[model samples]
Target chain A: MSRLFRSVSLGLFLCLGLLLISWWNLFAWSVVPVSGADVLHAFTSFNDQTIAHRIVLDLRLPRLLTALLVGACLASAGAIMQGLTRNPLAAPSVLGVNAGAALGMALVSTLPFLYGALSTSIAAMLGGGVAWLLVMLLGSTWRVGANEHGRLVLAGVAISALCAALTKAVVIMEEDQAAGVMTWLAGSLADARWQTWQAFWPVALISLIGALLIAPSLNVLQLGEDNARNLGINLLRSKLLGSLLVLMLVGAAISAVGSIGFVGLIVPHIARLMFGQDFRLCLPVAMIIGALLVTLADTLSRAVTYPMETPAGAILALIGAPFFIYLVRKRTL
Target chain B: MSLSAHQLSVGYHGHTIVKKMDLTLPDGRFIALLGPNGCGKSTLLKCFARILPAMSGEAHWQGQNLHHYPSKQLAKELALLPQTQPIPEGIKVKDLVAYGRSPYTGFWGKLSTQDHQIVEQMMKQTGTYELRDQLVSELSGGQRQRVWLAMVLAQDTPYLLLDEPTTYMDINHQVELMHQLQALNKQGKTIITVLHDINQAARYCDHLVVMKAGELKYQGSPEDVLTSTMLKEVFSLNAQIHRDPVSGTPMCVVED
Candidate 1:
């Protein structure tokens, strides 16, 4: 098959698979009534006032959409981060961006002043920005020679741990707010209301678009720092711009549904395996696979308990950890 | 256009590696920079290519300080192929070569028809056209080196700088790459390369710059500089020099 045809077909397959999973979860949960012809009935019925429609549209649909959005955001952010750092393992969570957003949300939630919905997101954005700045600064100082890849990874790990400690301390101080913060920290999509979706979707869309626009330069960057510079790619400007896009995507996703893990870490590797290493091709494929993986996880979360839903974050961990181990054993990453 | 370094001092993090190095390459000359390991030949070449920051002196290209030109314009003038492996994993050979056009491209740099033609010609010239669809990681050391050279060739610059471009290859591929570079120089592209092989440097280069411990030991034609005295002083080796049977270039035989 031609490259374009193969890519388009793969994309359609992923979209169809997500749709099937969404439908299955809806029927299994009795969110749409479990009839003998549940698939057919669910497709045809559109009574907005019915309990089934209300549950499917108001509750399940928003959560699903949130999962898809956050997953794509995290995966794209991870891909961009990995490309920028030129480290295969670099991701938002590993590089401290997620921890920073969580810290920001935790702080804002405890504020005595009445913080409206927008305040939490703004705080999360600031936290993500600050964390990235800290990583860059520390990494720069620790860079021993021409190769800074190892130093940057170490700096990211150190900063992530520090941010996690601060976040934990804040949680301890405000024990009452701890319950809400805990669920967010666990990275649940259950609380994704329409308002939360409104807050995150635009940032994710804009940043993803921006990332695709710069995808070509990323190929130049993969050639290493000196060669990329020789190609007339302004290394500093490209790094800063790419990091900013990552910050926006990751910060918005984290603020919407706190610290969803594994999607960022695993989706890019999977995309690289499936689509080869071209960033132009890998970015979109990663986004689709990211959406599919999270949606599948969210569907399993809703059905695993039947009536009682598990947090999608827990399901991702349960699925992702073993898959990650398998990848390591296979030496694919 | 010509490239000249005026008392150039280059190094990393405050320690000068190449100091007070003044050199000039007239347009279209094949210049070889020869030195022992850690003798600062690579540092000097990097300074000329603007890969390393000039610590205290100037690199002038076409009568203007190279530092004054924007990086894009500078890249358009010169290309460097540092001795390094191609990025690991599935980077296609054609895509790797196309990176040479990056300096001339805009933000959404689509490969123009001319750019594609140049890349195709470079691949053909470097004998990498057959491997255009192949992954760089799968190529042998010699083939990978040629692909890298093709990438630099696709840049279509007037001057090309290569740092030990013959490091990992066998004698045959090494000679082939040097011959290709000589051909390029003959086509009016000024070529400056750091070479470890003394005989290769003597045979291929129009001019030779010999360095010892970060300072110039000699600079002139290979016939003038690759003498027994200078070779022993710079390389700490006794060598006998003879005219090559074919090219009439200096041929060296080390004394035991």
Candidate 2:
């Protein structure tokens, strides 16, 4: 119980820390100089004319908010995947959602008539959903008696490779049409605007709430299939809702911020290590950790190269890849 | 209002494991499902627990179709423990057992005071109270088995279906588990267990159900069910029946 209290406090502290980091990210290392007081003033006063106020409201705020949402969506989705599959290595990126979404974005943006944001986002969601469906089907994840964990992961790896290869082929064939997509494909936060955030949050927030509502069901799933069924949980409903949540969360985040790779893979493990395997608790903690990690990484993306913005996704990969290796060495799977 | 099966055929991947069969269980009895390795005892138990869908027929609970019954209500009526349990990482014994209160708990699965008491009582009954705070992945095999039993017991159901419940237990724990189950049986909890020990089954169980090659071979009291002819026909064992000195139940003495 004390440990639970401690972890709860830790999560609250992380939230506070995230608020601070987000505040710092709003003004620090921007090409257009802004201040903390300017940030508060932009919120408190009418600021249609001032350049600094426009920069604060227009450019930085949306970027910071998008980073936070992308992190929370990916991390919570990762937690759900791990709990449902009972595999610690399970994440959206590893399971082909990221690669599939990228392939969808590449295909849409490279074509002449289909070059629109809303259409590309839809394509990403559909591509991710279809890819995940194929993985689940080929892996035989829902089948009984046969060992499915290893097979499921293997299927995801194969699908990811396939999607990535297709995306590369498309990008190479339409280099002039895909010039703008090249930087976005690197997972940068430079292009977020008020219009995209308006479209992004409502869907992302609803899916995040849905993820929390199913937290208890994810806990029950840890008991394996037959045991969970005996506990009165409708297996088909829970699994389907879970997979849908993953696609929505991943699709939205990947569409908003090109494919932030490692937050989903790493944040859930940290949450479970600190809070244990109870999804109700670990899931929210994972969201906080993910938001903080991405926000902090986005802030650091400015400092890493200074004045020349490194892609925040590249920053996350730098931190995430070694951690991935560490996890594989520490755990058997 | 009894647990019954009607021409049930259950399988997976289009391969049938249990063929068409019809049977009904006697309520408030300690029942033992005695069968050889491939006799479909566990499969039948799973069908009753609603863990597996029957391909052709229906399993009935309280005169209602088992599959059609609401999942939460069926959970309150029946609890099942399979042969093997996955050891979830970083879960405490107390919290693990508290999961049994899921059907009775609210939407978020928060255990109330009464739920806590039942969880405690079950942990104590299973001799796992001292290990309440220990991680499940850290416990030994026998200890883990007891913790799982405590979890199933904490479900507080009237009907229980256990498959090979005593697999990793020692001799003392095996007998202790039998005694505890017998006590629960006396208190009107109908436990149907697939047990390998014929002598132990006869000693504690009020009814015996023998199966062979997916067929129901016999069902009767211990005294009538432990005949040498039935033994040779079902288990391919040549055995003589004798009364147990300690329990006065029919015991099987094998002839080499």
Candidate 3:
């Protein structure tokens, strides 16, 4: 038991170290480079006249905060979804959540009346809710016994493909909005700002707390539905509340960061590999791992290309796809 | 009465499996539900355990409707062991058994010292104490079955419902488990199980309920219910029934 606590504390400390490094990296290695001393001076004593101060306060801080929050939110949501479906491959992107949220945001952007971050997030939540309901309806039709994981994956892929096609069709019809939509869909953190963090943090906090609260029920759920029901878990209520929380997390994330992928898909897997499968331990660790993963990826994306920004999603998939294939070969999923 | 189903109709998706059947299960008795495949034995057991909702009528616990009882309160009264449980990946036996304390534990599911002692006691009772640290996936089928039984026992309910609990065990282990359940019955726990083997059911269970095609064919002692003609009618097999020499219970030998 002490060993387990030691390992968890070690993992937490490692995450904190990485988060500090990410903060340093965010300040030090942007389009306009600032030295370590410059970063310190800018943070400790602010002057509007200094270029370092301007960059750190206006650009780096918000972008750093956005990446951390969005990453944590999406990854935690992915963990919950995996538990809900009892399928490890279940992620927001695979479940058509990202696509649905993107579609909602896209539509809201085009509409004259709905033009703010809150409206966009609300629309995204509604879209994600619809996708979740459809998946539940479709998933329930099948018996979902031994091959439930594979069948649900197939259903998710089909729904994702349909949503992707519809989103593309909508974007193509509007020529003026196409560039912004295309960039957002590619998932860059270049435009992250204070407003984005302000719009997102409450939802992220709610989601994190909600996931922690439901972690015990999820443990019972992993024993299967009948056993869980017999063990006094209200299956329908747990599942419904869990899915709603996932939607809030994913919706807030997509709206803030514009559909960053694979953090949701891969971070939970890595967390499980490091920690055990107990959700009480895994949920917090998953959030930490998620924050670390995206922060590193976003920092590397900006640094590798210098002035030209690269989408973090592209970098993540370049790494994530191979890992996914390895998992498939191992038959773990 | 431990559990009584009144005008109960159970099914899925508007199709009924067990329809409008009324029955009362007596407390502190070892009961066996025997039926052929697709005869609704499992479905009926699930209904009594409250895992499935009755399509028409009420299932009662101590004269109150089972549905009316709060789920946690009901769980404290009845423990169910379903067949074909999925093992969560990389879970240890001790951790798995700790889940049984969820009803008594608060929202965080933290195991108190008393809860841990109960879990340990259950593990020892089911002979899974040695395997507590091992991962579930690393254990063999029989060992895994015992571990699951320990989990159910850790729930420490007064009434237990098990559907084919002996599926993966060897003959020796099966008899051992039956004796353990008998010990539990002697301690005043009501045990209702669905069993495949007629001889084992007859030897171990005091009361027998036989079903055919979702309807109750017989409900009595094994001697009264396990007749050769009733065996042929219910199981569609030719069998000879005789009293066991050791226990004086009805034992059947199927004639091919």
For residues A246-312, write the lDDT of model 1, one tens digit per residue. 8888888888888877788799998888777888889988888888888788777777887776888
Q: Which stretches of candidate 1 lie over 4 Å from their true place?
A: A22-48, A111-118, A133-155, A327-333, B236-238
Error at B137, model 3, angstroms: 0.7
Q: Mind giving the per-residue lDDT tens digits that candidate 3 earns over B45-156?
A: 9888877788898888989998778889888889999988887787999998989888889999999999999999999999999999999889989999998899889898
| DockQ of model 2 vs. true complex | 0.85
DockQ of each: 0.60, 0.85, 0.86
lDDT of 1 by residue, B87-168 (tens): 5567899989998888877777688999999999999999999999999989988888888889888888998999999989
Over the stretch B106-201, how does candidate 2's per-residue lDDT look in tens digits? 989999999999999999999999999999999998899889889888889999889988877899889998999999998889999999999999
Classified by CAPRI criteria, candidate 3 counts as high
lDDT of 2 by residue, A209-230 (tens): 9999999999988988888888
Worst 10 residues of 2 chain A by lDDT: A111-120
lDDT at A198 for candidate 3?
92
Q: Where's the lowest-lDDT run of ten residues in candidate 3 chain B? A: B1-10
